[model samples]
Target: MSPVRRGEKLPIYNRIGVLRAERKMTRAELAETVGINVQSVGALERGDNYPSLDLAFRICAVFDLPVEAVFSRTEFGAMSAELYRRPDLRPEPQSDPGGAR
Candidate 1:
């Protein structure tokens, strides 16, 4: 049986790291503010792990950002085109903010 990969391509959300860098915050300080362990905060920044919804909320609150600003949902058709490098693989053209192809 073939293995099934689930979930959208979770494009990296290093916004946490961006926030930390902008604030010149240590991982320990950020973790303390977010009520998570320093290692968890480090992992999230490094993209070594994905955040749970609860953690996402906490991080967003800490950074004072709406969730959409911090995270993006992948559209499968876009992922397919990008991964395959085949423009023909894209879905019926939608209104793209990056400008229509």
Candidate 2:
């Protein structure tokens, strides 16, 4: 294994595993759909290998999503967090609640 690089441009994170789970699709299934092998699918999902532009586009097409929706340069937050963001997590308004400012 190679050392993990930080603050660099090479790292790429993806939501392939999450999307596959949502659709109940197996690695082999995805591999077949994308014209790759099972091991390559695993590699992509594990972030051990990066996909080429064509492969990335193919994967996005498989999920009916855009490239950014499937891949990111930074780490992704929890799927649920993105799906159901809490109102309380938002920045509070600066106005006085009691109206006595």
Candidate 3:
């Protein structure tokens, strides 16, 4: 697989690395579980290649996570940032104290 060009948008982004780290799973271990080469796992994690639908399903099964949680077309921002984001707590713009034209 070709390396993704810098600044090029990938068709899909994955949480494989995060998931592996969370589960303390090595690439070889995950590869064995998914019946793929270890290098393929690394490539998938690095966004060098997109997974086939079958492979995607296999990966999700290995992680026990929904496809949406494992992969997304849009970039998934940092989990901590997303979890801590406070939209409602954002300060509203101060209204004009006096009604000026």
Candidate 4:
């Protein structure tokens, strides 16, 4: 394997941590479910290592999510922020309800 440069960006990013938290799953639990070591799970979550195709499929199966939802080449932002961002539907500023100017 080639050494990663200090400032090099990862080729792929994942939502494993977010998905695990959403499901209240631990690294150990996810590791066991995916037939991998807990350390490997940590590495994957940190983007220190990429999973093989089979391993990726296993992880997706455990989460019951499509691979695209779990992994992406682009960075994934917070779902709440993304959902609330609406340049086309901005809310009008409200005036003070009190009579004071």
lDDT of 1 by residue, 1-101 (tens): 43545754555555677667777988999899878899998888777888888878888888788876666553223333544784556578668798856
Q: What is candidate 2's lDDT per residue for 1-101, written digit by digit as tens?
A: 55666655578999999999999999999999999999999999999999999999999999999999899999999988888987777777799878994
Better of 2 and 4 by TM-score: 2
lDDT of every predicted structure (CA atoms)? 0.73, 0.93, 0.92, 0.91
TM-score for each prediction? 0.58, 0.77, 0.73, 0.72
Flag regions of model 3 displaced more than 4 Å.
Answer: 1-10, 84-87, 90-101
Give candidate 4's total backbone clashes: 0
Worst 10 residues of 3 by lDDT: 1-10
Q: Where's the lowest-lDDT run of ten residues in candidate 1? A: 74-83
Candidate number achieving the greatest lDDT relative to the actual structure: 2
- TM-score-wise, the better of 1 and 2 is 2
**How much is the lDDT of residue 28 in candidate 4?**
100
- Which stretches in model 1 have alpha-carbon errors above 4 Å? 1-12, 73-101
RMSD of each: 11.9, 5.7, 6.2, 7.9
